[model samples]
Target: MSLRALPILFLFAAALTLTPISGLAAVGLAVGIAPPATVVETPPPPPPPPANVWAPGYWAWDGTKYVWVPGSYVVAPFPGAVWVAGHWVRGGHGWGWHDGHWR
Candidate 1:
């Protein structure tokens, strides 16, 4: 591998691979390859407290191929914020990721 690419690889290998920060989503994650289709998931039953919102899963590029991230419920950031699930968008370079956030 080229020396320039070494650091990028090291970052993924050292830390958690393909995983986004908890609650916070990645703003601009561009990848050369396109991600696979999103998996179809039947959301599990909501917990007793209706405070939590369901965040649907999407394909995550792990510096390589796509990986499936299952869906789950998350507590709202604030009183009335809605969960905006992450998604993939096509751009000139390739597919890019727009992570979910509270509205």
Candidate 2:
């Protein structure tokens, strides 16, 4: 490479090596950088009937594209309880799913 291009090439190489994980903060920092907020398209269908407490659907990574999974009615863990909405959480390298549950 030409001398002028050598430094530019080195900068690009360093950038690649320094790229941080999606939720990671600065290197060696325990705090994680919050992921960019996601815009959910076509919100999950309305929760199932009262009998099946509705669990809000969330975006899930499916290898190639983000897919929406329809929410379903679930039997409450106990009577007179409510269902907590599901959410996506940051894991070590990627996002993980926290399923809805009775609260």
Candidate 3:
């Protein structure tokens, strides 16, 4: 391959890798009817194992009804990373879920 073609190939590869990530973010941007607020009961936290952190559960829409996911301890994907709890936000049309991410 020519030297000039190498940069174009690298750019093409980068675009391909980032396409799926951008598409996933777009999918989460869909707005839907707001779900009723759920009152989550706090359960006593169990002893955490080494290098694990407690992830609080939240209500999720299952396309038919809201389901409560129980909280549990989750090991961090990488050192110094923290789990951000998911949340429902009010949008122009209704409500949407912002999935949690490690930061």
Candidate 4:
């Protein structure tokens, strides 16, 4: 409402236009910025039995900027399941998350 607040509001809007996505898929979260490129991570040695699949690192939006979520080994849901990495997608509203799923 005041002129002093206008600059702060503008800065927030600017930041959104240069950053990443929603906060872990809320009911309806949209981000104006496109996510940064995916981080290249060399996965560590596989863990013990049943958890050998490496879900590579990805950039996650933390309501502000993109944060690097390190890759980790996870157990496959089924006998021979393949892991599909999640990524950012552009939609009518804005950028949103396409959560990774098993194949």
Candidate 5:
């Protein structure tokens, strides 16, 4: 490889390594404002499809407003996996959402 190409290759590799780190940083940002009270709604019965799990929706910060995401049935990521619903918790900086994950 040419000498100039080596620097470019190094930059490309560095960018690839840092891309996911930046994405994770964004995902971990905590909202400083407390979301409004959650709306109570009765979820409809599960669909006829088997292995469908209920993912209860919550308010999501849109960088401008708190948008309500309605609950719905979703397919579990894997067999025997349970969906842990996301929730907002009080933190040092007002409130932040703890993202849900499959358990």
Candidate 6:
């Protein structure tokens, strides 16, 4: 290739790499590499309640982001009550976490 054409080739390569492409409906694309993994942190235990069962804290999925809801004791949702721990689930190429509940 002649010197005059070298600059054009370089510009074309740059444009190709810089172009953006959308990925999954719930996720977006990154050029040349996948996105970094999200680190999930375990929350501290809730303060002791008056003769109440303890509920584990977990991350909750908001429409466009994740929010943390603190755990607390409350009246049982049903006659017989139990606490279910919250967990993060893999969805749409990302993690969708469900908050804990006391029932």
TM-score per candidate: 0.67, 0.43, 0.60, 0.67, 0.64, 0.37
Of the candidates numbered 1 and 6, which has the greater lDDT value?
A: 1
- Regions more than 4 Å wrong, model 5: 1-26
Candidate 4, residues 1-103, lDDT tens digits: the string is 9999999999999998866444424446678899887778887764548756889988877777888899888898888999999888899998887778999
Winner by lDDT: 4
For the record, the alpha-carbon RMSD of candidate 6 to the native fold, in angstroms, is: 12.8
Q: Score each candidate by Cα lDDT.
A: 0.79, 0.60, 0.75, 0.81, 0.79, 0.54
Models ranked on lDDT: 4, 5, 1, 3, 2, 6
Give one digit per residue, the lDDT tens place, for model 2 in 17-82: 887664443223221334345544453566455566655555654445566666556777667789
At residue 23, candidate 5 shows an lDDT of 30
Q: Give the Cα error of residue 79 in candidate 5, in Å.
A: 2.5
lDDT preference between candidates 1 and 2, better one: 1
Model 2 lDDT at residue 92? 87
Tell me how far the alpha carbon of residue 99 in candidate 6 is from the true structure, in angstroms, after superposition: 5.9
lDDT of 2 at 8: 95
Clashes of each: 0, 0, 0, 0, 0, 0
Q: Taking the tens digit of each residue's C-alpha lDDT, what string does model 5 give over 1-103?
A: 8998999999999998876553355365577778888888776964537788878879987666789999888888788999998998887766677777899
Displacement of the residue 58 alpha carbon in candidate 1, Å: 1.0
lDDT of 3 by residue, 1-103 (tens): 9999999999999998876564365365544766566656564657666678777888876656677887777899988889998888887777788887889
**Model 2 clash tally?**
0
State how far residue 64 of model 2 sits from its true place (Å): 2.3
Model 5: lDDT of residue 76: 84
In terms of lDDT, the poorest run of 10 residues in model 4 is 20-29
Model 2 scores a TM of: 0.43
